[model samples]
Target: MANIKNPIIPGMAPDPSIIRVDKDYYIATSTFHWNPAVQIFHSTDLANWKLISYALTKGEVNLRGTNTPAGIWAPHLSYDKQSGKFWLAYSHMQNMAGREFNSDSFAMWSDNIQGPWSDPIYLTSIGFDPAVFHDENGKHYVSILEWETRTGYQAPGHIVIAEIDLEKGGIIGNWHRVTTGFTTRGCAEAPQVYKHNGYYYLMIASGGTGYAHGIEMGRSKNIFGPYEANPSGEPIITSSPHHLFSLGDPDSGHFEMYNPKSVMQKAGHGSLVHTTTNEWYIAHLMARPLPNTKLNPLGRETSLQKMTWTKDGWLQMIDGSNLAKMEVPGLRNSDATIQSDQLNNIDDDFNNSRYDLRFMTPYREQKSSWVNTTEHPGNLRIYGGNSFFSQVNPAIMATRATSLNYTAQTSVSFKPDHYSETAGLGLYYDSNNWIYARLCQSDKEDGTVLRLLQAKLGDRIDYIFDEVRVPNNFAEIKINYNLGTTQIMYKISENDDWKQLGDQLDVSYLSDEGVNGEPGEVGGFTAMFNFIGSVDAHQHDSFADFDYYKVINK
Candidate 1:
C-alpha cells in the first residue's frame, strides 16, 4: 500500500477543502493577501497532487491594501452530484481592527472544476470560514462562524447553518444556531456539513489554528438542532492530543500548547472524503517549525490522515488515537510510486507563452501590462510598479518557499537611470517583512550596484555600506536560505565565482509569530515566499528582463 506522508501539499497551503468526484480528488486552499486566490489542486491516487487552476483569476475581488492574514480565508469546495456543478464558498476578511472581524462570504458555481466560473454571488456578511453543503434532497446549506462582538458571549463565535438558494443567491430563511461548545476546545470555526447513513455530521476546527488546533465532529439526526459532540469528549485528530481547557479563548497562537514530540504541529481545519473503495481520509492543515523554534516559516500546509468510522457511528483516526500521524496508509492495493512534485524545487524558464500557474502576486492581479513573457520571448519582462512596502501594487512574482534549506537564483538584465529603479530576487513574507537583494543605480558612484534591504516590523533597514558595484548591467542574484538565516550572493559572469554581498543575517523575524501585528494575533499566516520583483518609483518605465528563475532545495 502507498504510505501517504504528512504535508501532502507543503508551504503556505492552508484551510484546505477537499472533495471527490468519481475517481478524481480536488482540493482548494486559502491564499491570504495574494492575487489569483483560492488555489485548486487535482489528484488521482490521493498520494500526489498537482496545481490545476485557480478560482478568483479575473479580478474577482479587490485585495488592495489588505493586511497580512486579512484577505481570503477558508475556501470550501463541494460538488453537487444532482446538478453536476461545482460550488465554492469563501470569506473575504476585510478588516480585523478592534477584533471586530468584518468579513463577507460569497459563493460561485461552475459547470466544471477548471472553469469560467460565474460571478461571485453574495451570501452573507456574517463571519469567516464559509462552507457550502449540498443536501441529498436537492437543497443547499451554508455553515459559517458568526463573529461575536459582545463581551460575555463566546469569544470567536458560533457555528450557524442556514438553507441557501442558489438561483436567488441568498439564504432561504433564518440561520439555525448550532452548539458552540465542542469538546471544551474553543475558537471553533470552519464548519463543514456532511451526511452519512441517516444523520448529518458537522465537523469543525477547534482549539484555534495554533499549537492546540484539532478537528472535532458532531452529528444530528436533523440538519440543524441539538448536535451531539463526539463521545470521546476530545478532538478526533490533533498534533497535541493532551487535554487543555481553553474555552472562550480566541487567540490563534497557543504557544503554551506546543507539542515538542511531534514534528507536525498546528494540525487542524480538516476536510473529509471517502474514496470509491470505501476508505476514508482527512485533509487538514499542519505546520513544521524551524527545528527548535516555535516560528513556522513554511506556514500552514496540507496533510492527510487515515480515518475510519466507528461501529457506533463516530469518526476516529484509523489507529484509534487523537494524535495526528506523520504517515498514514493510502490505497489498499495501489502502487507506492506516487510522490509530490513540490517537495524539492522548481525551475521556470519563462519560455512558454504563459506564466506558470504556481507563480502568484500579492495585492494586485498579475496582468500583462506590468508582467508578461510575450513582451520578450524566452524571458519574463517586469515593469516596476511600487515599492515593497506598498500593499497597493508591488511588482513581484513569487512562489512558495517549501524548504528551510533552499537556494533561489535569478538572472536579470536591467540598467536603471534612477536610484528608485531596482530588480532582483528576495524572500518575502509580507509587505512589512522581507529581505530583498536588489540591483539598482547607486547615487554616489553613478553606476549600477547590488544591495540588500530588509523590512522588519514596518522598519526599513538598507545595507548601504555593504553595497557592491556591479561591473555590468547583467548579473545573477542568488539567496541561500538555511533555517532562519540567509545570505545574498551575486556573480557578474557565468564563469565568475559567486561573491557574498552581506553577512549571514538572522531572518527568524520573518515568521508567523515573530512579526508585529494586532495584539494577540499571529503576525502573518501566508508564510515565506521566494520572489523576483522590481521597483520603479522614478518614472515607472524601467523594466527588467529575467531570463530564468530557479529554486533548489537541499
Candidate 2:
C-alpha cells in the first residue's frame, strides 16, 4: 500500500466536499472574499491534487463589500449517476456583521464537471453549509444547519434535513429537526448525509471550529428521525479525539481542547467518498500550526483519513485511534503517480493568454481590464484601482501561502509618479492586516524608492530603515517568510545582491484567531496569501508590469 499524506490540499482549502465519479476524485472548497467562488480541485490518487475549475464564474456572485471571514462558505459537490448530471450547492455569505450571519444558498447543475453550469436555483437561507443527498429512489434531500438567532437556544443551532426539488428550488415540505448533535459536543454544523447499508448516516462537524473541532456521526434507519450516536459517545475522529473536554461548552474555541500530542490540530468537517476499489475515506479540514503554539497562520486545510466500517455498521478510521495521522494507508498497488510541484511552488512567466487558475483576487472578479497577461507578453499588467484597504475593488492578485517558510519573489517595472501609486510583492491576511514592500516615487530623489509598510486594522505603520533609490524603473522584490516573521528584500537588478528593506517584521497576528478589531468578532478564518499588487490613489490609469512571479517553499 502507498502512503497518503495528510493535508492533501493545503493552505486555506477548508470545508472539503469530496465525490468520486468512476476513477476520478473531486473536492470543492470555500473561498471567502475571493472571486471565482468555490474552488474545485481534481485528484486521481487523493494524494496529489490540482486546481481545475471554479464552480462560479464572473458575475455569478457579488462580493464587492464582503468582509473578513465572510463571502462564499462551504460548497457541496455531488454527481447523480441516474440523471447523469453534476450538482453544486453553495452559500453566499452576504453579511456576518453584528453576527447576524445573513447568507443565501443556491444550487447549480451541469452535464459535465467543467461546464457551462445552469443558472443558480435558489435554495433556502435557513443557515449555511448545505449538502444534497440522492437516495436510491432518485429523490434529493438537503441537510443544513438551522442557525438559531433567539437567545437561550442551542447556541449555534441544529442540523435540519428536508426534501428539496431541484427544478422548483424549494423544499417539498416542512423541515425535519434531525438532531441538535449526535452528542453533547455542541456547535455542530456542516452536516452531510449519506445512505450506507440499510441505515442512513449523518456526519457533522462538531466541537466548534477552533481547537475542539471534530467529526461526529449518527445513523438511523430513516432519513429523518431520531439518530443514534456512535457508541464511542464522543467524536469518531479528531485531532484531539483522545483529549476529552468541552462536552458541555456552548461556545467555540475551547482553547483548552487543543491536542498537544498530535501533529494535526482542529481535524473535522469531513466528507466521505467510496472509491471504485470499495475503499472508504473521509476528507476533512485540519490545521497544522507552528510548533508548540496554536497560531495557525496557514488556516484550516484539507486532510484525508482512510475509513472502515465497524461490525456494528458505523464508520470510523481504519485504526482504532481517532487521532489524525500524518500519513494514511493508500489503496493496495494503486498506480496514481503524483506530480512533484503542485503545492507551494509557483513560477509564472505570464506569457499565457489567460491567468493561471491558481491565482485569485479578493472581493472582485478578475477581469482583463484590471489584470492581463496578454497585454504585455511575458509580463502581467495590473492597472491600479482603489487601495487594498477598500473591500469594494482592489488591484491585487494572489495565491494561498501553502507553506509558512517560503520565499516569494517578483520582477516589476512600475513607474509610480506619486506615493499613492505603488506596486510590490507582499503577504496579506486581509485588508486590515497586510505587509507590502512597494516601489514608488522618491521625494528625496528622481528615481523610485522601496518602502516597507504594514496595515493592521486600518492603522498603517511605515518602516523607515534604509531607503535605497532604484537605478531604473525595474526592480526585483523578494520576501523570505520564516514561520511568523518576514524579511523583505529587493535589488535594482537580478544580477545585484539583494538588500534588506527593513528588519524582520513579526506577523503572527495575521491569523484566524488574530487581527480584526471588531467587538465580539471571532477574528477571521481565511488564511494568509502571497500577493503581487499595486495601489493607485493618484490615478487609476497607473499600471504595474510584473515580469515574473515565483514562490519556493522551504
Candidate 3:
C-alpha cells in the first residue's frame, strides 16, 4: 500500500462528489462565487488527482453579483453505465441574508466527462446540496435538505427524497420526508444515497460544518422510507468527535471549536467510492486553519480516508478513528507520480496558448480582451476593466493559495495614467476583502508609483506606503502569506533584494471565519487566493503586462 496523504485536493475545494467511470476516477467539487463553477478532477489511481475540466464553462450561470459562499454549492457527480453518460447536480445559492437560504437546484448531463455538458435542467429549490441517485432498477431519485423556514421546527429541516425524471424537470409525484440522521447531531445537509447488499444507505453531513462536523448515516430497505440511523448514532468520520459542541450553530465557521490536536478541521460532507482493488474510501471536505487560530485561509479542501462495511450493514473508518489525518494510507500499489505534491512551486512564463487549468478568475467569462496572452506575445496582457471589489469583470488571473505559508510573486509592468487605472499583485478572499500592492497613479510622483492597500469586510484602506518609487518600468511584486500574516515586498530587478512595502499586515481575517463578522452565525467557506490583476475604471483600454507568475511554498 502507498501513503495517499490527506487532502487529495487543496484550497477551497470543498463538497467532493466522487464517481468511477470504468478505470478513471472523477471528483467534482463546489466553487462559490467563482466563474466556471463545479471544478472537476481526474485520477487513474485514488491517490493522485489532477484538475482536468470545469462543468459550467460557457457562462452557463450568471454570478455577476454572487456573494461569498453563495454561488455554486455542493455538486454531485454520477455516471450511468447503461447510458454511458455523466451527470452533475448542483445548487446555485442566490441569497443567505436573513438566513433565507434561497437557492435553485439544477442538473446537467454529458456524454463525456470532459465535455460540453447539457444545459442545466431545473431540479428544485427545497434546499441546497441536491444529489441524484440512480438505483439498480434504473430509477432516479433526488435527495436534498428540505430547508426549514419555520423557526420552531428542526432548524435545518429533514432530508427528503423523491423519484426524479432526468429527462423532464421535476419530481415524478411527491417528495417523501425521510430521516434527518440516526441521532440529532443537528443541521443535516449534503445527503447522498447509495445501495449495498439488500439495503439503501443515506449518508449526510452533520454537526453544522464546523469543529463538530462529521458524516452521519442511515439505511433503509427501500429507496425512500423509514430509514434507520447507524447503530453507533455517531458520525462515521470526523475531525473532532471527542466532544459534541455547537449542535445548532448556524454558522459555517465554528471557530470556537478549534481542535489544537488535529491537523485537519471541519471534516464532513463526504462522498464514497470503491477502487478497482476492491477497497473503499470516503472523499470529503476538510479544513486546516492557521496554527492556534480558528481562521481557515485555505478554506475547505477535499480529503480521503479508507473505510469498511460492518457485517451489520454500517460504514466505519478502517482505522476506527474519527479524527481526520494529514497523511492517510494510499491505494494498494497505486500510481504516485501525478499527485498534487509533485510541484512545490508553480512557475508560469505565460508561454502556453491557454491558461493553466489551475488559474481562475472570479465571476469572469474569459475572452481575448480581458486576459490576452497573444496580445503581447510572451507576456500576459491583462486589460483592466473593474475594481477587485466588483464580481462582474475584474481583469484578474488568480490561483489558489494552497499552503498556509507561501510566497506568491509576479513581474508586472504597468503605467497607469489615472488612479483608477492600476495593476499589480493581490491576496484576495472575495469581492469585498482583499489586499493589493500595485502600480497606480502616484500621489506625489509624476508617473506611476507603487503602493499598498487593504480591504477588510469591504472597507478599503489605501496608501499604506507612498515612498516606494519604481525607477524601472518593471517591478517584481511578492506577497508572503505566512500562517495568517501577509508581508508585501517588491524589487525593481529579479536579482535585486526585495524591499518591504509596508508593515507585516495581519491577514488572519482573510479566512472562512474572518471577514464575515455576522454574530452567532457561520461565515463563508471560500478560500484565499493570490492574483495578478489590472483595474481601468477611467478607460477600459489600460493594460498591464505580467512577464511571469510564481508561487512557492516553503
Candidate 4:
C-alpha cells in the first residue's frame, strides 16, 4: 500500500497537472516568476519523479518587473489521442495591481513532451487557471472562471464553459455558466471536465486559494446542463472544515476563506488520472509551513491521494471523508519499496553537451556571449553583463533551493579591474531580493576588495560589509542556509577550511508563506534560488571562470 509522505515534489512546484500515457506518467507545474517557465517531470512509478524538460524556452513573454506571485499561474496539460500532440494551457498574469487581475490565457502544442514547443496561441481573456477538455466527437471545450468585476450579479466569478475552434483562435458557441461552486463551498477556479460512464464530471478548485482551499465536484448527464453537487454536500478533498461562501461579498470573487482546522494551508487545484494498474489518484497542490511557523519555503508541491467511486455515482476518497489523505494500494511497487528521500544532486561541472535543465536565467534570452563552454573545457566562464536592478538584462543562471538546510559553494577566478565587474555566489529570491559575497574593485582604495551585500525586495543598493581587502583576484564563496538562519563564508582553497565573512543574515522572510500581504498580494511565487552571478555595469569585457557549483544538503 502507498502512504502519505512528507513532500512528494519539493521546492516551488505548484498547481500540479498530471497525465498518464500508457505506463508512463508525466506532471507539469506552474513557475510563477521564474524564467524558463513550466517545469515538466517524468515518473515511472508514482513515487519517483525526475526533471524531463521545460515547456517554455523562447522567452515568449516578458517578465522583467513582474511582481511576486503574479507571473505565470496554473498550467493545464492534456494529450490529444487523435493528433498525438500535448496541449498546454496557461495564464500569463501580466498585471495584478489594485488586484485588477487582467490576465490573458494562451495555448501551446508539442509533438513530444520534451522538444521544441510551438509559440503560444492566444486562447481567451476569461480569468486564470484555464483547462481544456477534448470530447469524443472531436470537439474541444475550455472551462475557466469568468472573473466578475461588474455589479448586479448574484454570484461573481462563476465557472464558465465554451466550445473552442483551435484553427480560428476563438470560441464557436455561447459561454455556459454551469456552476458557481456555491453548494460545495464557494470561490471556484481551475475547472477540469471529463466524461466517464455516460456522465460528465466537472472538478473545480473552490474555497479560495488559502487555508480553506478544496476540490469540489459536480456531475451531469449532459455536457452543458444542470449539474448536481456531490451528495456529501461538502468538498471531496480539502484541508479546511469551514463553511464559507463566495456569493454576496463584493470582493467575494477574491475573498479569503478561513479554515481553522487546516493541517496544510492551501490544499486545492488538483488534476485526476488513472494509473496503469487501474487505480485513480488525484494530484493536488499542498503547502507545509515550517514546524509550527507559517513560513513555507518549499512552496506548493504535488501531493497524491487515492480516490474511489461512491455507490451514489460520485467520486470520493477510499475512506468516506472530505480530507485527501489515506493509505491506499500502490499502483507500482509497494510503499515500503519506494524511497522517501530521493533527490537529485545540484552539483554541476559543465561537462555535458547542454546546460542542466535546472539552471534558469532571469528575463532575457540565454546568450552564448555571457557563458562560453567551448573555451573552458570543464568549467563555465560567465562574463559580467548588467546590474540586477537594470531592466535591460542581467547575467545570472540559477537553480531552485531544493532543501531548506543546504550549502551552496562555488569557485570563481576573476580579475575585477573596474567597479562594474563582480563575481560571487549568493541566494537570489528575485532581482530585488538577494545576498551575495562578491569580489569587486573598490574605487576609493584602487584595489580589489571582498564585500558582503544584501538587497531587499525594494531597495537598490544596500551594502552590508564595505570593501575589505582580501586576496583580490581569485576566490571562492560559500553560502550556507540553515533554514532558520543563513551564513556567508569564504575561502580560496578547495579544503574544508572556510572563514566566516559577515553576520548571520536571518532569511526566514524568503519563504513563500512568510512574506507579507494577502494570498495574491505580494511575496515571490517560488522559493529562493542559489546562483553564481556576475554583473558588468562598466561596459567592459571581464571573464569569471567558475570551476564548479556544488550544493550539499546539511
lDDT of each: 0.91, 0.86, 0.84, 0.75
Q: How many residue pairs of model 3 clash at the backbone?
A: 4
Q: Residue by residue across 123-193, what tens digits does model 3's lDDT show?
A: 99899999999888888999999888786666678889999999988999999999756655677899999
List TM-score per model, in order.
0.99, 0.97, 0.96, 0.91
**Model 1 agreement with the true structure over 1-554: per-residue lDDT tens digits:** 87987788888899999999999999999998998999999988888888899999989899999987799999999999999999999999999988999999999999999988989999999888999999888999999999888998877988999999987799998999897857888988999999999989999999988898999999999988689999889999999998988888875688888998999999999999999889999999999998899999999999999999999999999999989988899988888564654454778899999877889999999999999999899999999999999999999999988888889999999899998999999999898999899889997748999889999998999999998888788889999999999988899788989999979999988788777765557777888999999999999999999999999988
- At residue 360, give the lDDT of candidate 3: 82
lDDT of 4 by residue, 7-63 (tens): 467677888999988878888999876778888998877777888898888878887
Best-performing candidate as measured by TM-score: 1
- Please list the Cα RMSD from the true structure of every candidate, rounded to 1 decimal place: 1.1, 1.6, 1.8, 2.9
Worst 10 residues of 1 by lDDT: 336-345
Model 2 scores a TM of 0.97
lDDT tens readout by residue for model 2, 343-381: 659998888887677898898888898899877888999
lDDT of 1 at 52: 92
TM-score of 3: 0.96
Clash number by candidate, in order: 0, 0, 4, 0
What ranking of all candidate models by TM-score puts the best one first? 1, 2, 3, 4
Model 2 residue 19 CA deviation in Å: 0.2
**Higher-lDDT candidate among 2 and 3?**
2
